[model samples]
Target: MNRLMEFIATGFYSGKLPKMPGTWGSILAAILLYFLWPTNLKFQLLIIFITFILSVISADYVAKELGNKDPDCVVIDEILGMEIALLGLSADIKTVFLGLILFRVIDIMKPPPIGFFEKLPGGLGITVDDAVAGVITNVILRLIGGLL
Candidate 1:
């Protein structure tokens, strides 16, 4: 059970990477997820939903164990959020680049309701805020893709 908890907490070992592990894990996961799956809207949305649900549930315990408010090692939320932002978008270099920038901006900025979710207790607070940011980024990406 202990090992199981750690595995989930660290995003199946991606969180354990040395130096900026969470960010690296997220980027790796996003890249793999983008390539491994069919580039379909429904598939991308499904991935986003699953990642969000799993991240929300697991993030709290991970944060508690790490003794930090959203520790850098607990970046499953970022991975899930980044995937969400890229959902249904073109997989071209330009599109992916924009998605990355947009997601990072929203995640970092945490404007309005996204910031509001950050105040919640435990892991819910930690993960949900990023989830909201991802959603916001997703909306913007969809809009930009439509315009282009």
Candidate 2:
């Protein structure tokens, strides 16, 4: 069970990378978002819903197991964050790649409410900040796309 939690939490072990595991996890999440992306928007929403639920549970357990409030290697948060970032966007190179960069930037920056959410309890703290970052990135993308 621990092994499975570890696997899921690590974003398929991308989190185990020697450096910048969060970055690696986000990269993996972007690639995953590309492949898992579907034409039906409902399926995309479902994917985010399911991944978010799983991320919360697994993140909590992994934190408990690893004895860290927010273990760097547990990047289910990144997976869900990236998923949220590209929610309504297409899987094209521009959308996926740009979303990756944007999400990473917002996630790393953690401005205002993003940092506030990061201070929440346990796994909620770990995931909420990234999720908000994704949402912000999505809004920015939509706004930019609208102006174009």
Candidate 3:
């Protein structure tokens, strides 16, 4: 149903919050990650894969319903991206919060290929950029963590 898809796409309506819905979704994701993050890397990857599929489907449906490309009310991408950003990291408050900030920045800035991925059609476009941002953020975090 549209309602179900909308709910998922909107990151359980965090995307409907005033201003920076993407950020809200990411915040929710970070909180979830902090509390529920799995210790196993395989489990983490499985969760990301499942979320990615759901995000793509739900985001595409919502985009078609709203007749807009990457509408503000669709932020499952942010959830997916946040997961990717924090992937494999120890789920501590500091790391989770840092990952959230890095992901939001990279996502907002849309640097390099991130922007390019956003140009894709449908849900793929909606989610790929955030995924890319997450990858970039994850790498940055790893490098930073390595330095410390």
Cα RMSD of predicted structure 2: 1.1
Error of 1 at 52 (Å): 2.2
Q: Report lDDT per candidate.
A: 0.74, 0.87, 0.93
Predicted structure 3, TM vs. truth: 0.98
Model 1 ranges with Cα > 4 A deviation: 18-22
Model 1 pairs in collision: 60-123
- Per-residue alpha-carbon lDDT of candidate 3 for residues 54-87, written as tens digits (9 for 90 to 100): 9999999988888888799899999999999988
Model 1: ten consecutive residues of lowest lDDT: 1-10
Write out the backbone clash pairs for model 3: none
User: Order of candidates by TM-score, top first?
Assistant: 3, 2, 1
- lDDT digits (tens) for residues 45-117 of candidate 2: 9988888877888888989988899999988899888888888788888888989998888888888789899
Highest-TM-score candidate? 3
Candidate 2 ranges with C-alpha deviation above 4 Å: none
- Per-residue error at 133 for model 1, in Å? 1.2
Model 3 scores what on Cα lDDT?
0.93
Ranking by lDDT: 3, 2, 1
TM-score against native, each model: 0.80, 0.95, 0.98
Per-model clash counts, in order, read 1, 0, 0
